[model samples]
Target: MTAASLEGAALTSSPALGVIALGLPAAVLLLAVIWARPGAGAAVRAAASLAVLGAGFALTALALRPAGPSAGPPITPTATLPPATCSPDGGLLRVAASGFAFDPDCLAAHAGEPFRIAFVNEDAGVQHNVAVYEDAAGTRARFVGDPVTGPGTTIYRVGALDAGTYLFRCDLHPQQMRGVLVVA
Candidate 1:
């Protein structure tokens, strides 16, 4: 993964959002209590409370801001696709991931030969990948490709496999993005 990918992880992942959303109010409240003294006048205490609320709002806004151009390298999806080499029976396969589901939700490839696939991730700024498992349970991997943050497309070079059906899914969201890979 690239540096931008690591940075994008926070925006796409839920844990980061949870921290900023929940932690901010707690922090703001703590500061309000510490800054507002019991001996202070009613007007002063009210001003401090308002200030704390404003600070929390501002901080949350900054935290939720989308990553800018300078955040890191950009991996934008492109129209150009990589070339593939395979038998006429099973050659290049195009697969796209979007809305946490794989289009077609099924794949086919020629067995006992090298396989090539053009994997495109349509979910912008969200990480997704096509992984071939030994079974539908995804207990094992026949081929696993590096995840790409979309919208972008990458190639997955899988080793030769015996003719059989295999499981394919997004490791990041296995339950949501999944399919079947049929090798013949």
Candidate 2:
């Protein structure tokens, strides 16, 4: 099955299955404690309580773990290309991504230029997306493409933009995969 389909299945599976899986062991331990010899019952109950406590601690640790930094290359701007001319169809920008970095990290275009960006993800098993924002901090998003797993491609069509320095990055690896879109 495709990776996307598998992820969807995992998300849509019945919650009852998870509940049953978690509760079955506790229930078994409870039954064991109840059926044990009179003096041994207390020890069994204590062991069961410790097991439940350990499980709870493990679940909490998994839920509260902090997401680490991106494993991709560092965010460094390379040379800025000259402004691209808009053709009769539209201006075209090609971006290739692999190992958490985009080729041609800095791009240039004329103001009010209608453009289509062809974003290609070449890294296997990595999910990436292209998003454009009005600011470098990415607080004001202008365009966000659907997340695509490698090897895959997504085309993002952007309307005419005013002269400014826009920010573009992979939403999944924003820290490592980012670039500047300079409109002159």
Candidate 3:
């Protein structure tokens, strides 16, 4: 299997293992405590407590361990831009970025039309860039801009895109900065 599939399998299976590792010992200890006599020797009680503590620690560590590659934050578009007119030469889309968000989070363009974005980063000391993806999840990247630490502007060029809805986001702030590009 490919690496991604393996990762998915691991994520799916680890939780069950973690629950079993944690739950079985706890249940056994609980039953033992309820049934054992109060007068039972101190040695038995101490050993049982130690066993429970050790199992708890081990299970906690296992449950908290990081699973394979983390899928970044989910894509949720917060803004939409008006449709842009295509120039005779091509289309020019203007985007502005400030405070972890992009103005006109949505944009429109014609299919097979070359387009360029005048991306202005208005937030100083914040690094940002635009990346286009095949899906809203930002997993299949079509194009990526050179990251710029603002305040400044950069031109992002995209060749002809087929008719579909594409996703765009700031690579550094995917959770807070995301939008859609619709091609007709």
Candidate 4:
């Protein structure tokens, strides 16, 4: 599905929609607690009202919280690249993946425009691959580049996506080499 569709689906998906549903009751209970404070026997009513509100708050927070892989935005390790064959008005970004690290851990790109990412393996005796992801956390990878095995270089062309945060990393060393890609 398209991004718009994904966003729409996200809005209605399990935890997101559940949180909204639970929040309404919590809000209502909080209002009730406030409103009950000015009535006769205010202290007694306030205490009971507050107790109910507290329970509602707890439940709401639990229901809205994400539980699994989709619980939070994905992440990618920092990366370093070499200079790119950039187009006019399109910037070039070079990320290097060497020694279990990605240099220049962040990049910015314009939305809806094509761009090229050049990958070079400066370290000897190791193979590396680049993968770009939709989320910053790197949980779900959106684009996977070919592995530039051993002391060589490769380039990955990524089309401009909708405005949002993204992730990129070396598949061979995800923990050590990753970074964020911000699309404006």
Candidate 5:
């Protein structure tokens, strides 16, 4: 993944938000305890500090614990198209990924057409995903496939789009893998 993507995901994740919530109050309480002196009440001040520290620790633990495997929205695995050398109409358009480069290097497909993109993750110790963008403009908003993880397969129905060229690539390994889709 790109540095920006990794940072974005980290920032948006729940644990990061929890850290912020836990930190702000702990900091405020610590400052207040240090500055507000109860004259000749050293024991009471120490007790209050300990209580604040314990509460902060508890909050941190609660934030870090996973919500279990089935916590959020269910991810229904997308259908996997069988390995094939050519398109349904006998046109060759399959891209194979091994060693970071997508075989076939490029492809073409009609708009509103159902085509199959076979993504194979051949590199050991490597994880990958393919994202099919609607047009050549690689904006985040218009995309068909939601980055299919590799060492796997996924079938992408080429959604209808204006007559133009579209692009596809591994979001995790962009420069090493890329392909095109021609929508007539």
Candidate 6:
């Protein structure tokens, strides 16, 4: 099934959110303790207790908050190229991945030529890679690249390929991102 669109109050980092987060539990506990007290000079003690509890809660909240998204190479989304040609640009072969699919599912390269395959993944927060195999079943491994998170570019230096059609796919999404590498 396709993903549903998000709705409702969007969460954002702000001092007010922090304050509300840390304030509720601490205030409730403080109020309970103050209400249960039965001794003189209780106001002074309650004031001090609230301060200590607030500080501890604030510190813990700040320490455990999840970090923001990491930085990656800048990429612009591109249309899927039907049978994208493996053309040499600045001494490297170019290919792009967007929307969980390679722009050109069909690519051609020179036989016996060692070239760099620059796989650009443009989907932010998604991971993708280029894997080549001799057979469509992926039984014969030729070249397998480490998965890179998008938006990022990974250069896989493929050794000279023999004249034949080979299978190329994203290892993470094997069936969905399959392609052909035509070495002629």
Worst window of 10 by summed lDDT in candidate 1: 78-87
The count of residue-pair clashes in candidate 1 stands at 0
Best by TM-score: 2
Identify the runs in model 5 with alpha carbons over 4 angstroms from their true place: 1-93, 134-137, 144-150
lDDT for predicted candidate 3 compared with the true structure: 0.73
Q: Which ten residues in a row have the lowest lDDT in candidate 4?
A: 80-89
Preferred candidate (lDDT higher): 1 or 3 = 3
> In terms of TM-score, how similar is model 2 to the real structure?
0.57
Positional deviation of residue 177's Cα in model 4 after best superposition, in angstroms = 0.9
Residue 128 shift from truth in candidate 2, angstroms: 0.7
In terms of lDDT, model 4 sits at 0.67
User: Which 10 consecutive residues of model 5 have the lowest summed lDDT?
Assistant: 78-87
lDDT of 3 by residue, 1-184 (tens): 3565445444446675756665777767775774486776778777767777677667654654555322334555544433443222338888888877888788777788889989999878778899888876788898899888789998988888888888888998877787778788
Instruction: Residues 56-158, candidate 6: write the lDDT tens digits.
Output: 6776455445543332334433223235455423436677888877877866678888877888999899889998888877778889999988899989998
lDDT (C-alpha, whole model) for all candidates? 0.72, 0.70, 0.73, 0.67, 0.56, 0.71
Q: Any runs in candidate 6 off by more than 4 Å, and if so which?
A: 1-91
Error of 4 at 87 (Å): 16
Q: What global local distance difference test value does model 2 have?
A: 0.70
Candidate whose lDDT is highest: 3
Q: Name the candidate, 3 or 6, with the larger lDDT value.
A: 3
Error of 3 at 77 (Å): 10
